[model samples]
Target: MTERAYFDELYASSPDPWDLAARAYELRKYDLTVASLPRARYRRAFEPGCSVGLLTRLLVERCDEVVASDLVAAPLVLAAERAPAATFRRGGVPDDWPPGRLDLVVLSELLYYLSAADRAATIERARESLDPGGHLVAVHWRHPFVEAACDGDTAHAEIRRDPTWRVLVEHVEPDFRLEVLERGAD
Candidate 1:
């Protein structure tokens, strides 16, 4: 998993380390992500690694409630300011996994940074926490980066290998990959 200090330093330097708010690519990707939701409205959603909460702002429109978290404090502060409707927490995957049933779980630009064990645990937690027919949306940049433990494709492939999730939507581009999976009913 990526260190907390890496994120701390990154957020210390810039509020939006990835230029998520300023980039057209990120804007379009966020739009596509919400558009791909299998359900028109979600009862509750959890978004881990919600940097600056740009996507969390969009998620609030479709979800009755959104709980968003990140490892760093700086972005969480900015995220709360940007998306006041959504609840912001200082946390990350596996260790800080939320409780209760979720109608939607979004892993955006997050999985690749996790170690294999952490990634599997994160996926398991999402699977266990989601209600029947709940959705798990994962979108990642399809490129290699120094900080990433694995490439985006590899991270996504790990999820796709699971038999319990039924694929609902798939969108792939040269720059990124997105998928929505539905949990089986109880």
Candidate 2:
């Protein structure tokens, strides 16, 4: 059910489950995610499934307000300390989706953890939340793992099907797929 228990168990064993802080791969990925954003500045952004907030830290530099959330609270505690500038909360996607319009929504390495239906719901939620002409960026690992309900290609291909999304940037690599799409208006 959206990998909540897996995350909880992972966090209980280690504060940083994937070792996101120390990985050069993650650093490069995060940099690419920031670089891919079409706008230099955003009014408000939502970063769901933000584990440890490394990306959220960088996002705060470009966004006026950032809401970073995770299903597991243990990581949010650390994420708050790591990125005090952004607001950190304990929440999940779809069901716990936040209220209010958004200028940007980041679904980073998070979609694969959910079942196909929830993944679509998460994307739809972003579509509904976006202020017209807002941006939605999704980054996911390309390879399949035991925890993933689907591969990056499957999830990203679904995003491409949305009628309102206009592709701004599509960066594909062996390791990951990153897409920055604008909602409404070509």
Overall lDDT per candidate, in order of appearance: 0.92, 0.91
- lDDT tens digits by residue: candidate 1, 1-186: 789899999988988988999999999999999999978899999999999999999999999999999988788888898899999888878889777789899999999889999999999899989998899999999999999999888998999898889999999999899999998875
Provide the global lDDT of candidate 2 against the true structure: 0.91
Task: Write down the TM-score of every candidate.
Answer: 0.98, 0.97
Best by lDDT: 1
Per-prediction tally of clashes = 0, 0
In model 1, the clashing pairs are: none
Candidate 2 deviant stretches above 4 angstroms: none
What are the clashing pairs of model 2? none
